[model samples]
Target: MRIGLYPGTFDPITHGHIDIIRRASVMVDRLVIGVAINRDKGPLFSLDERVAMLTDECRTLSEQTGVDIVVHPFENLLIDCAQDVGAKIIVRGLRAVADFEYEFQMVGMNRALNDQIETVFLMAEARHQAIASKLVKEIARLGGDVSKFVTPPVHAALRAKFS
Candidate 1:
């Protein structure tokens, strides 16, 4: 089976993320969304909360798109998670030139770590090219409307976190 891994902090999964996930699903037998647990980056939501929110959001996506989504929390290295899950490909969404530069570097590192694994980059839809989790959080924290950026469960989680 062609299993793909998509790793991110996903402070809160955005609509852009769901878009990528849906697009990636077309090419892979299974898509594992790995939520990276980074100690350096303090997120708006806890690991458990993020995982739960992602699970819920993905459930909604499955119903809407008829694609199976598996969400996993990873404290170890991404390559390790991919290896454990038997994922031979890593999927990433590129939004801008800067994102390409960064993702390219990570792809190289991942290749070095696992020579058999390959990284695939997908461009975010034009309308969502500028949306990101950090931006979503900033907008929500500032009391601006982020209903379009994040799922309803994520919005509720963010409100509960910031309130």
Candidate 2:
């Protein structure tokens, strides 16, 4: 079975993330969306909240795409998470050239840690490419509309947080 792991903090998963998940899911038998804990980011939503939100968003798609989408929250090394889930591939979304450089570095490190695992890069759809979770949060924090960038649940969560 070809398993792909997509790991992110997902403080609040955006439409761009959904785009990548949808695209990536098709390429693997099972796509595990790892909601990782990023201590550096100190995400707006708690780990449980992020997992809940991601689970809600992926529920229907998991069935429709014929991909077993597992929302697993992890606080350890990414390769360890991949190993635990039996993921042979790691999927990443690239929004721009800058993202490429950063992901390239991480991919190199991941390769060093576990040579058996491979990384694949998916370009974010042009329309959704600019919609990043960090920017979406900032926009909502300042009372700007983020409805277009995120799903209904996430948009509602942002409103409740700022309002």
Candidate 3:
């Protein structure tokens, strides 16, 4: 089966993330959402919380796409995470040229680590192009409405977190 790994900190999954996940599902038989445990990011949500959020979102997506979506948590290298999940392709979401520059370097590093695994980039929808988890968090923290950037559940979580 063709499996793709989409790795992100997912401090709280945003609509932009959901967009990528939805589009990536069609390219692989199974799409593994790799929840990265990057302590350096100082995530707002714990690993379990991130995983739970992804599970809830992915369940609906899997039902809609008719593809199995698995949430896997990892603290290791992204390439290693892909290998662990038996993913031959790594899916990435691109918002702008800035995102591409960083992802280009990552693709090169990942290829150096293992040339067998390929990287695929999916452009975010125009509406979601400006929605980022960090910005969403900042907006929510400042009492601004984040309904546009996240689902109700995530918006609620942010409310609860900031409250």
Candidate 4:
């Protein structure tokens, strides 16, 4: 089976992220949403919280697309995580040229680390190209509504955090 790994800090998975997940799911037999447990990054949501939230949010999409979505929390190198999960493809989302430049460099590094793994980039839809997790958290912290930027579960989590 063509298994794909989509790894991210996923402080709070946004609509833009779900878009990429949905698109990537269609291209692979199974798409594992690997949540990066990078404590050094100090993400807003805890690793377990992020995994639970994303799992709750992705259930419907998995049903609709017939793509098995598993939210796995990981530490250590991401390539190692992918290898552990038997993923030959790494899926990434690109929001703009800036995103491309950064992802391009990382892709080469990931390739150098594991030539057996290939990275695939999915372009964000025009509507979501500007939505970013940092901005979303900033807006939420300042009492701005982010209902349109994230799934309902994520929106609720943000509200709970900021409240």
Residue-level lDDT of model 3, residues 10-36, one tens digit each, is: 988999999999999999999999999
Better of 3 and 4 by TM-score: 3
lDDT of candidate model 4 versus the reference: 0.92
Using all chains and alpha carbons, the TM-scores for the candidates as numbered come to 0.95, 0.98, 0.99, 0.97
Q: In terms of lDDT, which candidate is strongest? A: 3
Residue 148 lDDT, candidate 2, scale 0-100: 95
10 residues in a row with least lDDT, candidate 2: 60-69
lDDT of 4 by residue, 56-130 (tens): 977988998999999999897989999999999999999989999999998889899999999999999999999
- Candidate 2 per-residue lDDT over residues 88-144, each given as its tens digit: 999999999999999999999999999999999999999998999999999999989
Which stretches of model 2 miss by more than 4 angstroms? none
TM-score between model 4 and native = 0.97
Candidate 4 residue pairs in backbone clash: none
Q: lDDT tens string, model 1, 38-142?
A: 979998888888888889877876676666779988999888999998899889999999999998888888888888988999999999999999999999888
Q: For residue 155, what is the lDDT in candidate 4?
A: 92
TM-score order, best first, reads 3, 2, 4, 1
Ten contiguous residues with the weakest lDDT in model 1? 60-69
Task: State the RMSD for candidate 4.
Answer: 0.8
Q: Per-residue lDDT for 35 in model 4?
A: 94
Instruction: Show pairs that collide, candidate 1.
Output: none
